[model samples]
Target: MESSLPSTQILDSGESAEGKNEAKNYNEVMSTLPKVKSLNGYDYYLYQGFWYAPFFLEGLMSVQEHFNPQSTDIFVASFPKTGTTWLKALTFAILTRSRLSGSTTSALLSKLPHDCVPFLEYDLAQNPSNRDLAIPLVSTHVPYSCLPKSIISASCKIIYICRDAKDAFVSLWYFLAKQRRSENVEPLPLEKSFELFCNGIANYGPYWDHLLGYWRASLEFPEKILFLTYEEMKKDTAAHVKKLAEFMGCSFTLEEEEGGEVQMIISLCSFEKLSNLEVNKNGKHRPDTSIAIQNSIYFRKGEIGDWANHLTPEMGARLDDIMDQKLKGSGLKLPR
Candidate 1:
């Protein structure tokens, strides 16, 4: 897969003349309408100078109302592209071992993680009754501050997965690049995109604040939130899955051990396995969006320190300094 944005003559949207022209075009394409308040009461911000509704937040409220939080229910939460799909697959396998009988077949596995543990936002928008489906599993990328108060206070378990900001930015860049290209919007140049990302100007960004919010919450309520790192899980998935199972009160049985079910589950949920599945690649869950483009591409690369290939030395140093300044004394550091 092409990881970097294509280098070519393109309009800019920064301080340069070409960038200003691009900005003008973006503004022209977007409606100059007033921002509207969403049903959940958050202000919708302008995207490309047009009022953009946060359908996701609206869906989240719907799911929140329908969710009957139980001690047994598990929620997987993350910032976008922070190994969410992989974590969802691993968690699903761990929780539903008895149902799967150790299979990751396309016929056996759900088309999307959203189908297995639906995104509280997307599903609720697609089918309001979908909220009732959250009894056992749900996943979200909503910031901790934005999540329902009940989820914060309930006995239900939450697993917050985080990734190094550099890698997360690179992954998000590629993900958005694919989306924009598909939508016929010109792709943002890599350098400018990286700058916007570092400045936390992208969608659902201000990455440090998002991660810190969860980190602090987890510290305050350790029993309710289990903070995890993508690097750690990539290093020893089986061990991590086992640890997760233990935390969620679901463990492999002796009979499952005899059948190597734990290892089977890990392999089944591997990046290569899930990314290649026809169901994952071809299935469509969101209206007007291709599953292959949106969900399947989510698992594009799970490699650690992959950002080194994209971020310049100076850029990396700058990011490191910013992270140090923001995360200082928080007892949290990005995994190497």
Candidate 2:
């Protein structure tokens, strides 16, 4: 969705040469950024509002460059803070229970989620070896257009997770605020941040467009992309997990459950279980760019209606109007 932030008015194409030079200089300054290594055998530079790894981009450019999608391959795709952690945990647990055979070490099971389902962005950068981590797992925030061309052509099965925009904005706002506070940078106040969020100015945003891209793709390729919502999953995780397992061609057999395997997986990957794990709580997985820590454990509160705590009536109404207009006729309604 577009951020609600005030729009910047563009100058006419006939602007003076001096103005153009100034604009160029401004862009150059904004684009200057630190470089980091990518998981996919390349370096990435954070610049001009997006992470750019020419090599990784090239890797995603070709479907063949991607890990072959086995019948076992499972991909989790989402915009940030949309219950990605929950889905990752559930997917990992479901896939690995047969191997675990009823292990009670919740810590080990929690760790397994990250090990099994590496995020295409965060985890990949720190551990290049993770690029080739086994099949039945990969997660990404990359928009539909940016996904590997081969994935599209091959019709690889993908799970797209979505959440209520209000809850997403609240969680994202707090997360960013915490990061900025750690860095001693002034946090973006809620009103201003909300405005930017509405305008689609947040990281990897143009949020509506990003969501719509995937929503449309899922509609056109229903067999290939299983569209899921965070609210629905939160309401019935086990059922959704079963659906996901079935979609990925890995449904639990009645025989497996006769051994209590399903419950074991569910207990192991529960949010309370994973969030408290020592490895996740204390581990440093990424470079802390001016912040105290990197890769803060992803298992944040997975509660619904979190926006009620942060959004003012006026702001909420404004957002409601925007949602109504943008999502009109799309059969996608923002949860109240």
lDDT string, candidate 1, 167-270, tens digits: 88888777767766765666677787777666655545567877888899899888878999999888887778878888888777777778888788888888
- What overall lDDT, based on C-alpha atoms, would model 2 receive against the true structure? 0.62
Clashing pairs in 1: 12-19, 13-19
Q: What is the Cα-based TM-score of model 1?
A: 0.78
Task: Provide TM-scores for the models.
Answer: 0.78, 0.75
Per-residue lDDT value at 199 in model 1: 62
**Distance from true location, Cα of 146 in model 2, Å:** 1.9
Kindly provide the TM-score of model 2 when superposed on the true structure, using C-alpha atoms: 0.75
Candidate 2 lDDT, 24-90, residue by residue in tens: 5534543466554322212344443344443333223223233344454567888777877778777
lDDT of each: 0.66, 0.62
How many pairs in model 2 have backbone atoms within 3 A of each other, for residues 3 or more apart or on separate chains, i.e. clashes? 15
How many pairs in model 1 have backbone atoms within 3 A of each other, for residues 3 or more apart or on separate chains, i.e. clashes?
A: 2
